[model samples]
Target: MMAMTFSPKFRRVSGAASGESTVRRMALVAGGAAILALGAVGGYRLVAQVEGDRGIAPLANSEDIQVNGIKVDVTAKTGAEARLEGWKLAQKEAWKKLGGPDMPVEAIDAMVSSVVIGQEQVGPRRYIATLGVIFNKARAGQYVGAGGATIRSAPMLVLPVLYSGGVQQVFEVRGPWQRAWAEFQASQSPIDYVRPVGAGGESLILTAGQASRRSRLWWRNVLNQFDAASVLIPYARLERQWPGGPIHGTFTARYGPDNTFLGTFEMDAGSEQELAGMLDKAVQRMDGLYRDALAAGELRPDPTLTTSGQVLDRAFAELRTKLMPKGGAPIEALPQEIVLPSSTPSPVSTAPAETVSVQFASPDAAAVDAALAAVRGVPGVRGAATMSLAVGGTSVMRVTVEGGSERLASALRGQGWKVTSGGGALRITR
Candidate 1:
């Protein structure tokens, strides 16, 4: 009958296979296939959520990004809009690389949604905008596993900085990443305080033994809490004595490192070079007031040192000799030292230097006076006089020897008197 057909072949079995059993076997196979298909679909969805097309892909003909399977190139037909689209594509990639944990932007430079001043470069000059990126996403996500199962998407908001003039760099989506900049240069600060609160004024840090009520009051009064605040000092001042005072002591007082005098403190010898340095600074200050005064132009030269009447006549006479113009004034004096001869009383040169007595050899006024006058007679001795005489057997004498020196003893002996000497002093016996 028209090549009567058999649509299927059946295998002979030990017990003839039943139609119902065959149908059942076929149904089982179909069910198994469906399960496999569903499994594949589920796998694909999971991958999409994590990788998003492997994070980066070729825009044009970039080398297949082999790094962590990320795609790194975007080549869109270029125009402002097209380039922007390309940038967006690229940004998607940048975000992907930055995806994992608290991945700090290794470095960031940005361009905002403003008109792209095209592209420029700062650091890796060749490629122009070579961005630095580093992150640890997988670790980060795993760390937050306890919080829940879902991985958060990229940050919701990104404040990209638009740089107009020029500068090229890669930028993260963070607000801090964006900064205004010129091409081939660094960027402007996110927060620039042009004038800080205490920029011009000075501040002193106050350190006291303890922050008692009185100490706090003193600190507040000396330093203005509003104008300039004084921070608390950290360390206590250390004092180390050399067992004996100082080998050669030159002492000064300072408010810590500030040179102004606060009170006297010891400066001693040691390899401790700090002592020498500090001493030099202190002594210099004592002698340097004129310098400070000069800086402020406040030095009024002493009349005796300058062109005061007596001095003026002599200087004027010399200045006139210069064949100088009659109207010209004398040269200014620096006023190196202040001579206060007039402030006190001018001493009479004709009168003798005031005298006193020598107690050692001289027990009477005549003896002490003679000793004093003899020593004063010595050539180099300017003047000499004694002060007091001993009370008990110690007996004291105040003798003024003209030029204070040991030669006075010989002069006294030459004056026909016996002379003796002792610790830190001398004696004359008649």
Candidate 2:
């Protein structure tokens, strides 16, 4: 009789240890929920307008990738040794795909941000896996001879609208197109992408149709709510060659307040199995196209949308001065204006009410109504209006109030809502 010894490593290990002392293993595949949850912890968040909640901020420089069909075998005294070697081989291949060529093995290991296991098969002494790898941008770029710094453009909101199955939608339901954008790491590109998760009412307003809206005034208001300078509408029309067949996607890159057509590209997925990866690739290409347009000065933000508020303020000041006299007849009848005993109120000019966009998770119709009512019921809330509504997700409401977000959040807290403040927006989830 022969005895096999198996010992588990305390640090990091996955899968069941079999009778053999040797082990083969695999890692780095994540679903949309898992990826989004990761972002919730450390990713930069921007409150969505209609779909208010935490949104994944652009990675600024990171990349998400999958290294598939990894099959490697190593002869070692132990199965753990063989498994570790297989992972090393897979990481090396992924690094090469990321543009790191001829780099030292030790250096490549340091650039790996994370690894997730998608598929793994363990034989007596063999291992196979489909791994997902996220590379640290700064380190990977250095090894690949790519630029290290990101030249970010003015912030532009991303509305990834998909046309599929004879319907057009943006966050109305779960779609691969929107998921691809959410999972994308756009740090290396010149364009600063402001992507919303579209949890609620935001999706209702920031839709495919919004790309065609030419009113700078409307754009200005929308941009103000999201703190975006302009908008990018990356439209994808998916055409299935046949049922359960290849998917051909026609993508167009449009930008600016007017949604000017920049360019279009076509990509295809061999089958439904390839659709997700194909969409991810298309996003990267779309980002590259945007970067190219920016380099050529073709993607400039509309000044009308960005500076229009200041222009309006100045015009209003002029109008007020002309329509309303600041001085009372210059005291023409008196030699000297008698000063009152009261302290001279230094021109008591009223500050304009700050518009605060409040986002809350509404899991049902009742919750939505409750949130809207709670917002309106808050003291100092001048008015509240729904900007976007997702019946069972996050919703964004614009609140005109006397004080800023602090005041609104304080009030919501009183109502037993968990409020988190970020980037001048409030997210209330209960």
| Deviation in Å, model 2, residue 71 alpha carbon | 8.9
- Report the lDDT of model 2 for residue 220: 68
**Cα lDDT, model 1, residue 271:** 39
Stretches off by above 4 angstroms in model 2 are 1-83, 98-104, 116-128, 136-142, 145-150, 309-430
Best by lDDT: 2
**Alpha-carbon lDDT, every model:** 0.34, 0.71
Model 1 lDDT tens row, 374-418:
654554343243445432323444433333435566777778867
Return the TM-score for each candidate structure: 0.17, 0.54
Q: Which has the greatest TM-score?
A: 2
Predictions: Cα RMSD each:
43.3, 23.9
| Tens-place lDDT digits, model 2, residues 1-430 | 2233435552234434442223432112224446677677544443333443423333343453334344455545456766677778878878777666787778778777777665666556666666666666556655664555656787789998899999998876778888889877665567888888676667667877887888877886677566677889999999998999999999999888667888999988999988977897899889888999988888877755644144455565566545443565333433444432223223322446678988988888788778877886775555566779888778898887756788788988999999998978899988
* Global local distance difference test of model 2: 0.71
